[model samples]
Target: MRAKKIYWWLVFSLSALPSLYFGLIYFLNPRQLGIDPVEVLLAESGQWAFRFLLITLLCSPLRRLKLRFLSRYRRMLGLFSFYYASLHAVIYVVAWIELDWPIFIQDLVSRPFIYVGMFAWLVLLVLAATSPKAVVRALKKRWVILHRLIYVAALAVMVHLWMQTRGAIGEVLLYGCVLFLLLAERLYRAVPLLNHQSVGKSANN
Candidate 1:
């Protein structure tokens, strides 16, 4: 149990390193952020958010491959994803727009990618809120259905990234391919169970 606790702290700290590093650099070494610190923060935070989200999604496939212990960290990874995602949104609102609600609403209307990104963040928010043991118990089977929205969030983030960064086309494609494979694997795994259910229903009928 001590070992498990230590491992959890290790993962929690490692997951937070990116944000910590970014925070330190932004305050202490602002020169490193180039002439556009706000833009740099926005880009870095947003990228890390999407990366963590992808890592969270990977837990399932890794568990299916026999690294069953990885399943235990999925919630941690998912919350970290939400952490970075919130950081991204905060930087955009607080730094980029300087807490200007009118400009934020303008962006929401004019920048369609912001809409996609916000949708993804909202999904993450709900998933994070319902991640606790108590909430999971309250949700019961519906928890599974609701949590499946992670795929939708993933796809939306892909679209958000693609729409926002034309220069990073290669990175976009790489993440897209990874998301596609993860989604495809999910479908592949579901097929046999679905077929079995169908057969059982037919037999019953």
Candidate 2:
């Protein structure tokens, strides 16, 4: 029990420190962020959001590989994804648009990427809100169905990133490949043939 607590504490610290450092740098030394600090912060937060979402999805594959301990940290990683996503939205509203509702609505209409990103954020919001143990318990099997929307949210994020990029699609392609593999692994596990193979192997053993 002590070890598990220590492991999660380490995970939380490692996950949070970079965000905290960037936040402080943005506020205390805006000059350090270059001329486009708002853009930099927005990208940084959004990237972290994507990363955490990927990590959350990776947890299941890792568990299948026998790293069951990772399951415990999945919820924390998912919540962190939402945290950075919310920060990204707040920066867009407060810093970029300066809370001008008219401009905000206009940008959302003008930028299809913004629309996709916001939709993804909304799905993350739903997942985060229902992440509590009590809520999960109450939802029962339905919780699993609702949380499966993470895959959709991830696809939306990739599209959001892809649309925002001008040239250099290398990074986007890399992340997309990773998402593809994760999805493939999930499908592989779900296939009845694979299940039967596993059962046969166990029986033979």
Alpha-carbon RMSD, each predicted model = 3.9, 4.1
- The lDDT of model 1 is 0.87
Q: Which stretches of candidate 1 lie over 4 Å from their true place?
A: 197-205
Candidate 2 wrongly placed segments (more than 4 Å): 193-205
Candidate 1: tens digits of C-alpha lDDT, residues 25-131 = 99998879888877888998998999888888888788778886656788999999999999999988888889999989998898889999999999999999999
Q: How much is the lDDT of residue 170 in candidate 1?
A: 90
- What TM-score fits each model? 0.93, 0.91
Steric collisions counted per model: 0, 0
Candidate 2 per-residue lDDT, tens place, 104-145, comes to 898789889999999999999999999999999999777887
